[model samples]
Structures are given as structure tokens and as C-alpha cells.
Target: MDIDHLTEITANELTAAQYFHGHKCPAMPQGLRAGHLAMDFLSVKRARGGSELQAIVEIGDHHFSGCFADGVQYATGCTFGKGNITKRGLGKFALTLIDPAAGRAVRVTAKYERMKMCLEMPFFEQRRQGIPPYALDPAVVDPLIDDVVNRQWRDMFEVQTFNHYPVEPARESFEAVECAECKEMVVLPYARELEEQRYCAVCYQARVFRGQASGI
Candidate 1:
């Protein structure tokens, strides 16, 4: 659908997400809905910062061709910038929401049938045939968008609850170490010590690559 059509019909959060994501596709709204449902089920507010909630998303690199991550980020506020969202790369359409303070969590998964329906739709066929969603006929794309935006949660996903799930509280202290080569400070959880010298992962990899190259 055109920009004006999308703005008129889609929910405000999703409309903002489409603007941030730079395209209108079904997978993004699916992720947004999943995030919203997870938040509701967990009885938690949308995370304002890192400590309040954590989201483990299972969308792999080769999933449906769209920015599903952005949708989840927008809906849940568990963004990479906030250090609250992580990717599992399991090629599954699922996410686990954790509230560390309450020790409660839920795993929300898009039902296989729902995914199959999306795969069988004309939208997917057009995408497979090298037609972008915006380039396809609006009649073809608009209905898919509407379905994603309006579908009921029970109709789209399977949400499994885990009461008393153990969630560790956010770390409050870390030993800061200086990377010997880069001379940059590295945080404890991510700093690696090699040959008695601390290095960030990036610098360590670069040092290893250089060492191997020098030997060759």
C-alpha cells in the first residue's frame, strides 16, 4: 500500500515502526504483535531501559525477507542500543520475554499454520519472484498488512508461560580492563586475556589474524 494508505489504516506503533523500518511488509507487523502479546502476558511495561526486561528473539539471518528485528525493537523497547535484546539465530519465529524482578517469563511462538498461510499468500510468491512489496499491486499488499495489523493474538501465536523462571538481575559491577594493543578500555564480561594482556574481542581477533599472517 501507499504511504498515505498505510498511515491511515495501520496502528500508530506499527505505523511508526514502518517509518523506522523503511518499508511495509507483513513479517514486521508479525514481530510487533508478538512483542505486544508477550508484554501483555508477562504483565510488564514496555522496557524504558535495559534492566526492566530482556527479550531473546529467535529470528535467524535467513528468515522472511524483512526487518523483523526492528518491529520487535519498536514494540518491546528491547533494542540492541539498550543492550536488552539478543538474537538466538535458531530460524524459529519465537521470542522469550523475561522479567528479572518477578522471575516470570513467557515464550511466544508464531504458529506453524500462521507461518504457512503467510508463505502461501500471493505476497510471498511475489517476493520470491523478485517483486518488492511496494512494487506489487496495492490490492495484493494491503490485505496482508490489514490481516497482520488486525489479527487476534490467539489466532496468530502459541504463548507458553513459565512462572518462577529464574532470571538473574542485571549486573551492577564489572572490572574494567585496558586492551593492551588498542589501548581502549574493555568491560569485564567481554574482555579477554591472552598472553597476560587484556583485549576486546575485536582487537583480539585482529591480533590473531595478524599473528597468523606474520607466520605465513
Candidate 2:
């Protein structure tokens, strides 16, 4: 989340593919890229209730073709969502050149591509504070939101995921089975207690069934 570190890394990345094998410049297109990113952040927040960015790094689009980071695709807005387009010209998506001694200067350009967007935007400047920028993508967002909402309901009130089972009323005992050997009687928990009583409780544990009930 350090913008200065991201800026340093972005400036030194290699973009030598067939698509991005253009002249490598030490500095970013200041005015254009920075301005576009700012605007995108504001618009995204206004519509979706808040800002959702993780780590924004400026890199060449071609370098992202088959590259992946932490199991996510590098480009095409795969980190967030492809359909996540922000409102035009409503936020801080402007490009500016930074000079430590002189001061940060804005660079004018036609338009800033999303890949060219950098992480120079400060966290405090964000409209929605404390929210990470990673969940902005629709693909990574919907399921996460559902998980949070459902987990809360489940934990708060022991809510079952599926339909509840219908409770059956208790039944009365019909016939009591008495053991002739010990005179111990037990009410059958289930129906049809015919062959259920072969031995008394003590004899049952002592292997008395072997002598009494013979044959299969």
C-alpha cells in the first residue's frame, strides 16, 4: 500500500514483449495516468458505496498476458472485475510527475490506460477509509459479500443452511418385554419388539445370548 514503493517498482519493471516493447522511460506519464486513476476511484466509490482497491501497480498490458500474481491473472482487470468501469472525469485519474526537490509535477497526455495506473494515491485521501482496494472486481466481490452476510446470520442465531426438519410427537409404549431370567422389563423404543429381548441387561453384557437364542 506504499505508493512510493509501488512507483519505484513500476518504473523499473520490464515491458519488452511484442506489444509493450516501446521506449522504456524512467518516469511515468505524470498528468494523464494519475488523473484517470483518481477519477476512477471516486466514481467507483460513489456507485458501489465505497472504494475497493488493493495494490495498484503500473505495468505494460502485454507483460500481463500469461503472468499471474497470487493465483490471479495479471491484466485485463482480473484482479478486480473486467466490467468495473468507473465514471468518466469525476475523480482523481490524473497523471503527474514527481520531483523530490522541486515538487510533484503533473504530466499532460491524451488518456491513461488502466495498466498504466500507479499506486501513488495516498490512503488518507481516499473517500472510504480502511476498505481495501482488492475487492473492487465483480468476480472477487460478490461471493465474498455473500460469505460475510451469511456467516454473520449463521453465527448470531444458529441458523441452519437448509430447511428445518419436522418434529415428530412422542409415542406411548405398547407392550413391555420382560426377561424371565432376571424379571427385568424394558419398554421398546421401537415397534415390533419380538426378538428384541434375548437376555437381561446384566446377562446381555456377560454373553448370555450364546446359550439362550440358538440358530441364526
Candidate 3:
């Protein structure tokens, strides 16, 4: 499982990741690099619509670098639709990639010192000025992505690995039932029962269930 992280990832792989990510930015590629590193270290293959691996991203909503998770998903094949990715809501850019079957995991973070260089780049300056990354000029964004993809992992990331990482195995549900309110099919475990009528969480009178609204 000792492959050179620098050489193992290909340009085509990053291109696919960028396409899946739908924009060019350093944070996403930083995530791509980190995920590639973790997978290589663990000697694991990318998941194919299954929970072969899991990603816990320390990133909160409405913050910078949240795009990192997309990169991780592209590289490791852990995705929300597959129920293999989770957010820690810690408002940071870090990935804990896990191979549950092997009990192996690697936590990767872009080094703050190096990341500051990225933040100071002109690309981020435009981002700070209320311009969306996708709308930014390619000249501004492309250079930053190039820097991220070409940088050495030692300069870019901090990696902490575990051989005996503890993981709660995922429970896959195949059974579904109709919601009493919206009438949509929801997984049996995710269905909520209130007054003996099952409904999906969204239609379950959430405020009432939480004792905040009337009709509990």
C-alpha cells in the first residue's frame, strides 16, 4: 500500500473531479488532494454507490471551503446520496476518510500556514468581494487550482492516521412505507409516528413533535 501520493493521482482524475465539482477553486482541489492521499495511504479503492468507505468532513454550511466535501466525494466515492458522507459542522476544512472494513482511517487537513498563501491569492480576493467562484475569470481561478494541484503534500496537508479506528457500521434500510401526510415513501426507520399515523420527518408536524407547536 506504499504508493507515491504525488504520482499516483492523474491529471484526468482531477479533471473529472473538477467537472463533477462544477467550478475551479483551490479548496476543492485541496480536498481532492487530501482524499487522494488518504485513499492511497489506506490502500483502498473508491466506493461505487456503496458504503465501502466513509468521509466525515469538518465543514459547516455557509462557510468557505465547504466545496471540499465535493472533492472528497469525487476522490473516495463517499457521497451523501449513498449515505457515506457526513458533516461535522465544525467550520473547518478537514477530512477523516475511513475504511471501515479494515478499521483504518486518515485525517487530512490543509496546513494553515500553506493555506494562508492560497487565501491571499487574487482568486480569494475576488471571492471576498462577493463574486462567486464559478463566475470569476478563469485566469484568476485557474492559477490557484494549478498551485493546489501541484503543491507537495508535505507543504499542503497535515495527516494523522489510525490503524484501529473505531467506526459505527452503517445500517442499510431496504423497506419503505408511505407517509400519512405528504404520502411519499420514506424508509421505515426514518418514518415518524405521531398519533399512530406515520409520516416522513418533513411532514410529521415537526414543531409539535418537538413540543414547540400545538397539537402534540
Candidate 4:
């Protein structure tokens, strides 16, 4: 991430970074979509302190975002736990993932890019030791994490012109996301025309929401 020793980025290099920033990651699978993961972390040295912060992830389509607790740098993927990306004195952004094909980039903003820079180096270092696919948990969360990052990168190009970066939700809160009748979380089919229904067949409301029951 830190390229200080490596040849400095020139205006042309910056432009190239911006181009890649906009064009990466191809389309994902039907069940999988793209987005960003924002993790909030805290800073220690800032003078006006109660809970200081480092960076926040902000990438993906729909601006899908999340924020983790500050100083939980490991949680968010920021190498420099709670310092500003540019100033290091001013804490403003977090690392991001860039994917152009989907026309999006996770962590496509300045802050997120910095976060990517800081964290990526350390992550690779760890990889050198043993960690693979970039410190991602090999089993469960990896796919979710990977898809989100790719989609976010693609989305960046589709939405805005920009520089390098890597690039949540509240509801439309679906009260029904978790079903009361069946006590199970509902799953929505891939298409917009499809319906939202519980995964379980016996659930009372599933058929109704799926438009297979009722007056019709």
C-alpha cells in the first residue's frame, strides 16, 4: 500500500489508477450482488478524545455501507488503525476495493483508498507468512466479502468519474425480513418481479407473500 519507496505516482499514474478505479470486477452470480462494507474504527492520539476514530468503509452500488468500532482496525482492514489517510493527522477515510467491470469500486473514495493502501500492505505481509486471498477468512465470510468489494468497484465507474480507491442499509426496513409466523428469516428471489417469502415451505405467510395464496 505504501509506495513511498517505490517510484512516486505521477499525474499519468493517477489517471491510470482512476481508470482502473472505474473499470474492474465482472458481473457476479444471480444470487450474489455487489456492494460495500463500512467498518468503523477508533483513534487513540487525537486530543479531543472520548472515542477517537480512524476510517470508515464507503464503497459499492446503492452506497451499501457499514461502520465498525474505531481502533478495531483489524475488523475494517485499515493498517493504520485510526489516522487520516492523507494527513495522518486528520482522520477522515478508510481503505477500499476497486473493481471496474461492474463499474463500481469498494471504498472508492479518498478515505477508503487510503484505508486500502494502509491495510493492503500489512495484509500482504501476513499473506507472505500464511494468510491467503488477503487475510480473508477462508471459509464462510470470504465469498460475501469478495462479492461486495467487486460490485462496489464496478459501481464506481457507473456512478462517477474518479481517482483510485477501493472501494448499507437500513430498511427500507423489511419487518418481514424475519418472519413472525414461522420464526425464520425470509429470502427474496433474484428478480425484482419475484416475491419475498420464508425459506421454509410450511410458514403461514410465505404463500401469501409469494402471491400464491389469498383472494387471487
Taking the tens digit of each residue's C-alpha lDDT, what string does model 4 give over 1-216? 321121222435323432433321111110012112222111112222212222333323321121221211332223332232212322333343222222233332333453354344433345446643323444433443344333333332222322443322112222435554556665443112224433344454455565654555
Worst 10-residue stretch by lDDT in candidate 1?
A: 1-10
Every candidate's lDDT: 0.81, 0.28, 0.84, 0.30
Regarding lDDT, does 3 or 4 come out ahead? 3
Give the poorly placed runs of model 3, Cα more than 4 Å off.
1-7, 206-216
| Candidate 2 or 1, higher lDDT | 1
lDDT of 3 by residue, 42-128 (tens): 888888866689999999998777888888888888988998999999988899999999999999987898867777888878899
- lDDT-wise, the better of 1 and 3 is 3
Q: Which candidate number maximizes TM-score? A: 3
Model 1 stretches astray by more than 4 angstroms: 1-10, 172-178, 194-196, 205-216
**Native RMSD of candidate 1 (Å):** 6.0
| Ranking of all predicted structures according to lDDT, beginning with the best and ending with the worst | 3, 1, 4, 2
For every model shown, the clashing-pair count is 0, 29, 0, 46
TM-score of each: 0.82, 0.19, 0.88, 0.20
Ranking of models by TM-score:
3, 1, 4, 2
Model 2 residue 104 distance off true place after TM-score fit, in angstroms: 65
Model 2, span 60-149: residue lDDT tens: 332221121211112112233432222223232222212212222222222334223322233212313544333244444344323322
Name the better of 2 and 4 by lDDT.
Answer: 4
Best by lDDT: 3
RMSD of each: 6.0, 26.2, 2.6, 17.1
